[model samples]
Structure formats: structure tokens, C-alpha cells
Target: MTCKKNMVIIRSFKQRPVCSECQMRSLSGPVSDKKFKKLFDIDPKFYETSAFLRDIRYQYSLYQNLTEKQIAAFKRVVDEFKNPKKKQINAIVPKAPTKEEQAEHKQKRAKGLFQSERSTLRALRTK
Candidate 1:
């Protein structure tokens, strides 16, 4: 019988590796003309400028705050036009709701339903 010393090596085959540039691209919402210039050191063509601006605004609004790591990443992109080789920025992965959190959410939803029911009952009683 042959024994495997590194289970990770076997498991690695099952998972696909994603590059940092891809990860950054995924996290980035959109680049504005100004931001695009800052990051890429090039402006969008005259026709595409407005659309590019809108996209950047949308992305900024969508992500309320940029983390330090994200900011550093932005800077890093500006420093080097080439794709980042290192995965310095940690991807934000939302955690699954815990049992307690799920229960709390359910309780809040139930309370909202109860409030609506009570309001309806009061309205019917008044009429």
C-alpha cells in the first residue's frame, strides 16, 4: 500500500488557482476617466469618456468605503502597469450567517409581520 504524505497536493488538483489580477478586476467596480488615468495612466477616448465617468461613479457609490489594502492595490496598479504577481489584497468573502444570526433575522422578520398584522387589525376595528 502506498501512503500520500501531502494531502494538499492531491486536493490542489480539485481546485483551480485564480490570479491576483483577476481577483482585483473582480473586486474593482469600474474605472472613471480620472481614476482610470491615475491607475492606467491613459484616458478613455472622447466618445467613451462620459460612459467611463458614469461607471466609475457607480462603482464608487456601490463600494461605500475602500479598505487600506484595496487602496494600496490601487496604488500598486498605478505604480506598475503590468499585472500584479502577488496576492497582497485579501478578497472580501461574505461569511454565511450563523444559527444565532439566522434566528435573529427570522425574529426580526416575524416581528415585522406581526406589526403589519396588528396595523391591519387596528384599521379593520376602526372601520
Candidate 2:
């Protein structure tokens, strides 16, 4: 009688947990303590990444400086992450103003002041 070889089949059904990059993207927007806790509860390993931890620390540093709207936007993004259907590979996060916006804003302000001054001088001359 010939011996029969055994056949083994392996089935892969489980998905790997979210990676650090994904978790960090999930936290990109501003978050409150409650939202922070919720995220930590979902994945404690999120803070394992150095960059993610640094960002969290940086955001905290400005805890008192952020406007209500900014904080709310952050909360909304975090909430999206909490829900599985809304989870995405790359979330759209709001960014702060760039040097260009600052420069343009300054130029606009200067132009407005100059126009106001010119109008005042014209009025004085007419009177």
C-alpha cells in the first residue's frame, strides 16, 4: 500500500490592525480630551509612533490658543475615524496659514490703509 501525502489548507480571514501611519492620519485634526481618550481606547498603540506622539504634544501646547471652530473641526474628523464606514486611507485635514497667505493679508491691509489716508487727504483739500 502506498502512503498518501497530507494536504493542509490555510485560510486568511482576519485583517491586520491599523498601522501607525493610519492612526496618525486619523488624529491629524484637533481633538479634545474626550476624543483623545476615545482614540486611545480604540488603539493604544497609536502613540507608539514618535511622530504621532510629537504631534499630540504640539497640539496640546496650543490647547488654549485654538479657536472654537478649529477645535470643532478636529472633533468632527476624529469622530469620522471612530466610525468604521468613514475611515479612509487619507483623511482631509485642515492646515494653518502659509507664509504666502500672511504676506498677502499684510499687503491687503497696507493697501487699505493707504487708500483711507489718500481719501482723507482729498477730503481735507476739498474743505
Give the TM-score of each candidate: 0.22, 0.25
Q: What residue pairs are clashing in model 2?
A: none
Which candidate has the top score in lDDT?
Answer: 2
In candidate 1, list every pair of residues with a backbone clash: none
Model 2 clashes, total count: 0
The residue-level lDDT of candidate 1 at 77 comes to: 44
RMSD for each of the candidates: 18.7, 20.4
Model 2, TM vs. native: 0.25
- Candidate 1 lDDT (Cα, whole model)? 0.48
Global lDDT scores for all candidate models: 0.48, 0.53
Residue 84, candidate 2: C-alpha displacement in angstroms:
2.4
lDDT of 2 at 104: 92
